[model samples]
Target chain A: MTELNELTIAEARDRLRKGDVTSVELTDACLSAIEGAGALNAFVHNTPEIAREQAAAADARIAKGDAPAMCGIPLGIKDLFCTKGVPSQAASGILEGFTPEYESTVSQKLFDAGSVMLGKLNMDEFAMGSSNETSVYGNAVNPWRRGNDETALTPGGSSGGSAAAVAADLCLAATGTDTGGSIRQPAAFTGITGIKPTYGRCSRWGIVAFASSLDQAGPMTKSVRDAAIMLEAMCGHDPKDSTSADLAVPDFEAALTGDIRGKTIGIPREYRMDGMPEEIEALWQEGIAKMRDAGAKIVDISLPHTKYALPTYYVIAPAEASSNLARYDGVRYGHRAKLEAGDGITEMYEKTRAEGFGHEVQRRVMVGTYVLSAGFYDAYYNRARKVRALIKRDFEQVFADGVDAILTPATPSAAFGLGEMKNADPVQMYLNDVFTVTVNLAGLPGISVPGGMDRQGLPLGLQLIGKPWEEGELLNCAYALEQATGFVEKPGKWW
Target chain B: MSIDTETAAKVAKLARIRVEEDALPALAQEFNTILGFIEQLNEVDVDGIEPMTSVTPMRLPRRVDEVNDGDQQAKVLSNAPDAREGFFAVPKVVE
Candidate 1:
């Protein structure tokens, strides 16, 4: 029998189907891995009894020949997603001790597909920070290393725990949500593959909203094929979410043809900005060279409005977040502060919100409120919206010119030292999202694949962006690149 | 465009967050830093450009006028910490 730690979801399903391994054994392996790697801090909550019971039921179903597509595969869900009876805190003090009675659409879909839940992984508070440091739970340590050094490095965030768990072999696969590169950035930092499907492709119904228009749930896995399988299981239309797309869901796994011959791939000239580290520039060129070797037609294109993406995203995301988070008052489903003498209902609300939200969340809310206030609305929010439209129009023109996909670096540079970014001003940190935010603003599908490592030996990721609703083609190209580059490997023991 | 401590405190109050007066200085400094970064936008020339709201230029579809969401009173009120007679209870405003 293959050791449960090394088995992929497909292999686990095959073993379960042949009656060679019971779901109980697979769940035990994952639970053991979680116990063994407790120092990694990948999981916020692990319920082995619940997982084993679910897995046993799945084993019974398979014995009765009624196995689902994701039968008995144990997966880690990011804590940002709501799971019924499980506390969905978004790793924030504000939402401490809150549990949703209903499940998020993606988590519900995974459960319906017969996947056993391993546990909820950690993330930044309200998905605010780039590094997982902002999490009420501590930062998730990276599962990679520099030679002879065992210092704990960040796995990236706000999905750091999801990426680290998968990289450390603690889970077969994990779920992540990307808003301004949350999924892809961490996946790169941890040497994993993650795809952020187009916005609205996955219903946002029970997801704790962080910038609703940009927020999208995707998969973080060991390989492109694994990501494809998980993405297929996670997508669908729901009337509950008015923004959810009403379209036919395609078999993303079936769409993976390891062929990219004659495909036109565009390299956006604007993404090759000055001040980008030389190593990343080399990796970008290396990606182009590999694609060309694989029979792809590489061409240079320009997204002239690219420089405006960060500013535009900052304005719109916070504006939407400020509105969406208004629902989280003390009286509702989250933490409520104790009332003092002479305090009325207004005081109760003020005190509760003050104690509940974190510094970053509060800062965002203030900025959002300031921009949307009556006098500043048109000057800030409205102007930012116009720039967002121009950015989309730029992509439309490029795609119209026969470019099937665009290639860019996932981030400006590889993972920096743990406290290197935390103390910097917010906009400096927001600039790290420069390359990925444009895709979100355009509502296009984007994926991050392990391209190569930097001089410091940390891994680098190359992003492939596709037009709206073309996730299948986008992932197919990613699989082809994966085969061409061959960059997938386990992180060194220092992790 | 730099914000002072008093302005920061007022902004926090308007945003429904409570910041102790002593903490207002730090908040003001942080806000000024962020505003300083946002000032980069002023450097760009956007002459004759129309402001955009969403990335996709398409307008949202409108549904016919009808009462579609009026039936979930109990479910909605279930989340209320203080509800009476099937309505959310707030402190009376008028004297």
Candidate 2:
């Protein structure tokens, strides 16, 4: 039997389909791997018995010659997504015992495709922190490092667990959500491939939303092809999500064309900031060189409004988050604070909310309330929205200027030591998403592919920002780059 | 602008979050720090610019005026800590 840790989702599926391997065996191997790697803190919950039963059902389907694309694959689900009968805490103490009766659209689709659920992965509380340290269950450590170097590195947040699980070979792939670089940043940190499709491409029906307008669900996998295959299984229009697009779902697997001859690729001048690290710059240049060698034309373009993206996102995302999170009152679902006899309804609300939300979640809610307040709405929220519009317009102008897509570094630098920037104020962390957030604001598709590693052997990623609904072209370009760079193998130490 | 502890307490109350009286000073400090960061926007020349509500500048398609959802009262209240007769039960607010 091939080691479960080394097999990609595609390889595992092919073997399972041909009766070379059974879903039960693959799931058992994954469960054993999880048990061995318990120190990594990748999972918040594990359901071995449940996974076995699901795998048995998948095997029965295969025997009957009826199986979906992702049938029988063992996968880790980020805990933020609602799984019926399974507790879906956003890794926060507030929602300690909350369990949803209905599954999230993404989770339901995956289960319907015969994907076996290994368990719920860990994450930062309410997907707030960048270091994954804010998780109530504890942080997920990166699985890669030099020999005997025990300095724990952050697997990135708030999808840190998903990335760590995929990296540690605990599962073939995992579901991840991106709101201001959550999915792509973690994937970059853990040396995996994650794609954040265009806004509304995937349904957000039951995901515990952090920032409703910005939150998007995507796939995290070891290779670009696996990501594409998983994405095809996860995406579709849902009538429940009013924002879900009615556009035709393209066959993402078939879209993986290893051809980029004569494509116009834009190297945005704005991405080259004044304080970018030398290694990141070198990696960006290496990515451009590879693409150029693949018969693509590279052009220097300016997004003059690039500097405003982070500030605008901070304002808008918090404003929406404040509203979306209002559902967590003590009267409804989630944790309720113990109240005295004299305490009234208002006091109940105050106590419950104060006890339920974490510092970062509270900070966002406060900022959101302040911005949306009667007097300040026009000054802060309104003005930030205008800046967001200008940023989107900037992308449109660049695309109009014959640029097929934009290539830049996924993050400003490789994953820093855990807790390195956790206390350096919020703007510092918000600045980390400067390159990735603008694409979300523009409602366009963006992807992160493994570019190469930095000097310290930490992984680096190259980001591709495509025109709205142009994920097909973006994936083709990424496949071309993935083949040319050939950086898909796991880190030696991680193995 | 400097935010005092009392004002910070009021902000917390208005936000429906409770903070211990002793913790008010720290909350006040954090609020002032965040306000200070937001003050940076004043330096940017946004004069004569129209405020934008969305990045795409496209209005979402409006549905016809009709009742659509909110019929799943049992499902909605199923997760509640205390629900009575299909409604959230809370302490009395009347005098």
Candidate 3:
């Protein structure tokens, strides 16, 4: 029998309605599991008290016979989303001891829907790095290990902790934000499901900003069906966030009919990188074969500007990050430098920021400052923005031509050992987002579904990119893909 | 385009982060490597293309310029590292 902590949100909901289990029992099971799993470093902040209180309230709600789908469900929130009275530092030293008086719009929605908060999960500082190593709370270790090897692999980051927790069944599911593949790449790395909905599908009101134009919040789960259920609960129109779409939240769980008979799935030729591993290639082909056998028409498509996505992203993301991060000036809130007798305001700003930020965060800030500098703005920032248009246009043209979804490999490789690439060039780490960043730039909905395992027995995933603002349709395509692949592998409990 | 140590120092100052003089060389080298990678954008022809302002084509939803809520002075200053008399305290700016 599956452990209570391991039950999917859908299962837990059904059992909850039938009175087979109370949420407090499930919460206790998860809290005990988290206590035993310290090696993963997944849950940075444990809120068992808050969780128990919320779970008890959920039980009371369900007893009244009017509970939503997410009622009684426990979840791990990424540290980026500020929870009222929780130390939401975005895993940065700059925000030490700083707690917010308000909750982020996304977290509030989940709570109002009767969900329980497990705790704040770990992440890259300011959501800047592709690996979780840059987190001030320490890196979140991937629960999945290579066959018989003892090396600790990364959970692929900035949402690394969310991926680790979901993969290890530490929580039912966790919220993740994807700005150029933080959610999808980690989901692929840890053998789970993650979807980055259309850019404005979820509100970003109180979440820490990385790149304003690209960052989006979505669900990371054990199955595509859970992603659908949780995503419906997480998204809606919020007047607090200007970018959030003022549209009706559909019953996403109802859209998963598992009948994608006549959808057109596009196979983009440009995603075939030169040095990609054969296992990833085989995984992509397997997804294509599975979708074709499910009666979906597969056609070869061209995304001509795909090769330039990463370089363009590095330019734009850092440039925006430099601007957004300017708020940490040792004033108003967060860390402040100790001042000498002769020190002035400028000196205080310099010392505080230097002491607060990690090396990767500092590097990106410098890169951003350099690109947005007067001399290079037009060459680096403006040119990249124009290329961004072309990239988005590529998706629009394809979708306009009746391509319902695009299929590709989620990551270029499986999870690497922690510190494996630390000695290598930073550009090597940036290459990991190659296949996943285009979805963000084009502002399209994308889902990473675990399809198969690598030779090392690490999990591999296939990504399905869908049209903008059509996540229900995308989840259906992903549901059909999940049914065809039937990937149900779980990570062994090493932690 | 490559960055020198002097330029790196200038950027660090501009960004309000202090990079020690000894660390400037390493910072400049990292910048050059990233900038060199980003040079791939120059190969694309964007002669008449307009830079993208927003990914979605919708007009910005403008609200009437009015204060919807405020008056929480204690809540706003609660997270400050240094606060005094309902205000954030900082280093002396003027003599």
TM-score of each: 0.94, 0.95, 0.99
Which of 1 and 3 is the better model by TM-score?
A: 3
Q: For candidate 2, what is the DockQ?
A: 0.58
- What value does the lDDT take at residue A398 in candidate 1? 91
Each model's lDDT comes to: 0.84, 0.85, 0.93
lDDT score of residue A301 within candidate 1: 97
Error of 3 at A382 (Å): 0.8
Write candidate 1's Cα lDDT for B1-95 as tens digits: 87898888877887888888899998888878776665556655666677754444445655678777667676556555567898876655455
Tens-place lDDT per residue, model 3, A233-315, is 88999988888889898888899999989999999999999988888889889899999999999999999999999999999
Best by lDDT: 3
**What ranking emerges by lDDT with the best candidate at the front?**
3, 2, 1
What is the DockQ for all candidates, taken in turn? 0.47, 0.58, 0.90
lDDT of 2 by residue, A305-403 (tens): 888788787788888888888777787788988899899988898889888888888888877877787788877787787777777878999899989
Candidates arranged by TM-score, highest first: 3, 2, 1
Error of 2 at A159 (Å): 0.6
Candidate that beats the other on TM-score, 1 or 2, i.e. the better one: 2
